[model samples]
Target: MKVVLLQDVAGHGKKGDVVNVSDGYARNVLIAKKWGLEATPKNLNDLKLRTKNEAKLAAEHLAAAREMAEAMKSWKVETAIKTGENGKVFGSVSSREIADEVKKQYDQDLDKKKIILEEPIRSLGMHEIKVKLHPQVTAILRVHVGEA
Candidate 1:
């Protein structure tokens, strides 16, 4: 029996794939568990339409990410914090702080986890930070720290 997989199954095919399996297995395991559907004409056509829509959405996301990456390259975030006499910041600046600052200054939302800071900002100076906007896009942002 031929079936269209709704989700991945170990030792078998992935979602959206059509595979032939024993009729008993298809009826008892796949259809009973709602993990797949019979490869009828209607189900196959539905899968085709769904795949097309998903491709279009993915392309739109990639374009948006590219535009954001270009804009981020020329942008800088300025922040001030309390400092000691030796120019060391009283506390460290975290990725959450940077993400909030970006939103406040540029009106752009960013995930804190995407702000790749190998270490927290602990000194007063200009620093470069890497932001992963997408799997294929990375942006560098300038951060300037000054004493408050």
Candidate 2:
């Protein structure tokens, strides 16, 4: 049976790809879950239109990500964490705290999942953090950790 995938299917094909699948897969799995539709003449045409619309939306999203990346490139966020006399933080800073601070400062609500820290900030110093805007769009941000 032939089907048009509505989303990426592992080991088979990606969204918008028309593929020949087993009858069981088409009837029991894909169709039942609304992950795909049977490839009829009208369905294929509709899938093409849907795919085109999705591509346009994806391009727009990519453009917006790029713009946000450029803006974030100039960002340097300062954080004050309680530290000891030896300059070690009592508690390490997490990505959620930094994401919240970013939102507080710039009014940009970034996903905590998109922030990447190689290691927790445990000392008072300047550091660099990476923000994953998209699979390809990334920005390095400057962070200054001060003792509070």
Off by over 4 Å in 2: 7-14, 20-35
lDDT tens digits, residue span 1-148, model 2: 9999999989889988989989998999999999999999999999878878988999998999999989987888888899777665799888888998898888998998998987778877888899999887988877888887
Clashing pairs counted in every model: 0, 0
Q: What's the TM for model 1?
A: 0.94
In the range 52-121, model 1's lDDT, one tens digit per residue, is 9999998998899999999988888999889887776699889999999999999999999999998999
Error in Å for residue 114 of model 1? 1.0
Q: What would the TM-scores of all predictions be? A: 0.94, 0.81
- Whole-model Cα lDDT per candidate? 0.93, 0.88
Which ten-residue region of model 2 has the weakest summed lDDT?
A: 83-92
